[model samples]
Target chain A: MSDNITKGKMIKPENLVYTKSRVMTDNVTSYCPGCGHGTAHRIIAEVIEEMDIQSEIIGVAPVGCSVLMYDFLDLDIQQAAHGRAPAVATAIKRLMPEKFVFTYQDDGDLAAIGTAETIHACNRGENIMIVFINNGIYGMTGGQMAPTTLEGMKSSTSPYGRDVATMGNPLKMTDIVATLPGTYYVTRQSVQKPANVRKTKKAIRKALEYQKLNRGTCFIEIVSNCPSGWKMTPVESNKWMEDTMFPYYPLGDFKVPEED
Target chain B: MERELRLMKGNEAIAEAAIRAGADGYFGYPITPQSEVLEYLTMEKPHERTGMIILQAESEVAAINMVYGGAACGKKVMTSSSSPGISLKQEGITYIAGAELPCLIVNVVRGGPGLGTIQPAQSDYFQATKGGGHGDYKLIVLAPASVQEMADFVELAFDLAFKYRNPAMILSDGAIGQMMEKVWLKPQKERSREFPEWATTGKTPDRERNIITSLNLDPNKQEDFNHKLQAKYREIEKNEVLYEEFQCDDAEYLFVAYGTSARVCQKAIELAREEGIKVGLLRPITLFPFPTVIISRLADQVKGILTVEMSAGQMVEDVRLAVNGKIPVEHWGRMGGIVPTPEEAVENLKSKIIGG
Candidate 1:
């Protein structure tokens, strides 16, 4: 852990540690208190702040709970239609090749309705990063079953638990995208804990660095939590995600560059 | 001081003119009758020449969303599609309108309620002039009847689109899109690096972060934004009504049409004059601004009005509404991709308006 990020009572000029990332605005987020979106949002801000490329970034926010991501991040953002963020990001990057462009999308937006867009944009090898969040259930739409929902997991639509025969199996999208030659880097991480949060931030930073190489697409899937949708407390959701979600979606790099 | 004349199809003319108009990007899916647009762009390699970004998107939906992405940055972006493809693009089109982004959308019309035919039809008049998407939004719809108009309206559409910060559509049909005519191509204009103040170029220390979004969850705020859009539309209707009158002076009958039907109606007017019938044609260039006032004024002088269309009488409703019973208004149309001939059109005008 960094020694500067301490909770101790050391209030000196050099010892001062706690302040919000300047990339994050003062506006209150609309996410549930225990939702991992806030952490994911904070990590994004921290990474952008630390990278010092705040002015060079252009983001496309997806149509989900994080649709208002632009409201929190102090960067130019375009809110996209459901599942079309990657296509939107594709245009932005193609037109402004010099700018750092990315798409912030959730499981429903990535693997379900926008499957064609996601695959084609990735296939095109657009020099952009896709910051994907996989939260098993559709949190914004009252815990409906999402494409990435774990088999046998109960949701509002899958009230009797997801039947693999009828509902299809959970899509390992990170693995699927990793197989694409267009992807330069593909990783699946989580933010259920502080350590995982750090790892995720590092992955995002690496994705941005790889983005500068102009090789291909960089995809980072954050297997996050939705406590309110999961009908669990934040702590319980973390344990459940570690137990159920991680087994199905392991946190690791699926694809890496030959050198990096 | 010589014009560079080229024999081009409407679809090709649009693609060439877009490059000459300094359009920044084009994202389109290849559909019938309009595939030539994407084909021409791909062949021309406009990116290598004019630095225009052209992409063959996976679907019409993705293409329109890509247009949204570019237009968000104040880029002169456009896409061309046929009827079914335009239906697929409605979702993205609504979002672009709701966000008040500027872009050009070209609908090279083919017949369809559902894959009806590959032939020319004006069935989408209701969809285009009226709200095609779910909102109180209207695209600045331009009816390009000729290859020359197809070439000219590319720059005109972008100008109006950027001026009003709204989407503009070039509503051409398969007849016009596939028909070949000589077009005087414009000189190449340089693409701009300067973006608009509201464009999402990037938030620097100099300005606040720019957001291009349609979502205003607050009902009160959404209502206020809707009012603002309506006001903008009203201003457009007041100032941007464009139409052409052919033989309307001292005429007793009016033929209201646009696009392919207008071309047919012009011939019908000549055919009627040969039969000692006094007829004129009022062709609406801007279908949304609609030439409503002129049609209403023309109603006072005309004995009756006939809206000649390729569809089963869609624009007739608007004509009847504009006339408001001051004069009889009737619709003569042929569905399933049938383009009514001049003789048949005059015959319908004679029976539907003069006799009925």
Candidate 2:
């Protein structure tokens, strides 16, 4: 930021091209290199800033890589036990309906251990947002086979590669949750490139905006990359995510409200 | 409306008491013996009357976590369950304790050791007192012997829960939960919106955002939190121990009991006194603080102490620990959901200590 300012004209507030959202804290994120959690956090923080709802929003973090989200995001956060964020968010939103509540969870937390909470909270039409990060494998716990682990995807637990016969097929959770009547908006997105990042931000803004209408749950599933877990470099992981992960967990809206 | 007297089941009284006490939320699942609590709350439509939030959760596990969330906002919230259901709730209870969030939990205990029976039992004494969940923590355990106490303790439990910033439990049994009695309900209290500065009530510019969690990654930091919690428990032990004494003056023998066992012991005391045995009863209302000091003083004055219970002598161990072998201490209990009559308890005491 200082270098760019030195080379450019004396910068006035109005002339600034970009700045980090104030809702984000100064603490450096602990997510691994090429991890999507950092980008997801930035997008949400930016959305909250743009909507000026930082003071009126409460977030729930799962017991995965993003467990320390409270340290990075300048918002009130309650950490939920593995796979229970949806249930926790449901109670928070139900009690404080005027406030916006959301749960940030990963694939293992949402699609596996938390499947019941996710399904029931959505099915009950809870007025909350679910930021589901599907990175194919569990990243924090040594890259184990998650419910969304693709077939032939090798992980620490799936040393022989995920055999669909034994390991089961990867769960397409957003599709299933979208089919539920309670969900107002369901989209699968990515942030692999600059264009994708902008689109994902728009999707997040739409999800948060829907909460004001008192609609049911707004679930946005981000098909993400886990560089360290996938045993690939940051650049290689992004390319792999675009080439492999996106093909299966296609990036697009599975459900949305009718045009008003 | 002014306070009214009505005949109600213990479970029903608890529900009404919570609403009248200005509870902000009630989250629970249906369980045997205690199902009437949720049923009564739902039937009363407190949502329309007092704007209280009532949610029937997916399971005992989900219900407890919901209570955790509501409590995180520093709202007066509670849940109730039976033995197995409470067992499922232990995980969330521990988390609540670790987070130092105040909430009330009611356990209408039934026989257990794997669905033992729905009949009343005191088998959860050790589980309740010694920290049922994983982690070094304690719940201010309150034992209610009658429907009135069951109703009254709901408010008292919430008071103590917030005062200590710890979880409180109404450790009743199926007998009390199902039995009916006339209770003079307390006047309704206004719903309080005041919360501590630490509550997560959406951050304002005046204060830093509050984070409600128990996760301390650093071992030393975690240890410090544990020590702080231990200090709070010690203070509770000093100030919150409560017990009721019946015919204890000029008595030669004492009976230590709680909950329904205490009620049964009251009758046994009468039976023994008629025979000029000089027996007395000491009923512990707060079980976690265990009434240890009073029990110690009574141990020095009595010839022998008999700890009666519905389960196989769970509270007796605490009595022995408190008695410290000052006098003879013995346990008399009927397991497998058997409620020993006054005559049976008296006979057991006679044969075990007085004569044999």
DockQ of each model vs. true complex: 0.87, 0.71
RMSD of each: 2.4, 1.7
Candidate 2 Cα errors over 4 Å, as ranges: A1-12
Best by DockQ: 1
Fnat of model 2, as a fraction: 0.52
lDDT of candidate 1 over A139-167, digit per residue (tens): 88889999999999999999999999999
lDDT of 1 by residue, B33-71 (tens): 899999999999998888999999999999999999999
Runs in model 1 lying further than 4 Å from the true structure: A1-9, B1-3
lDDT of 1 at B84: 96
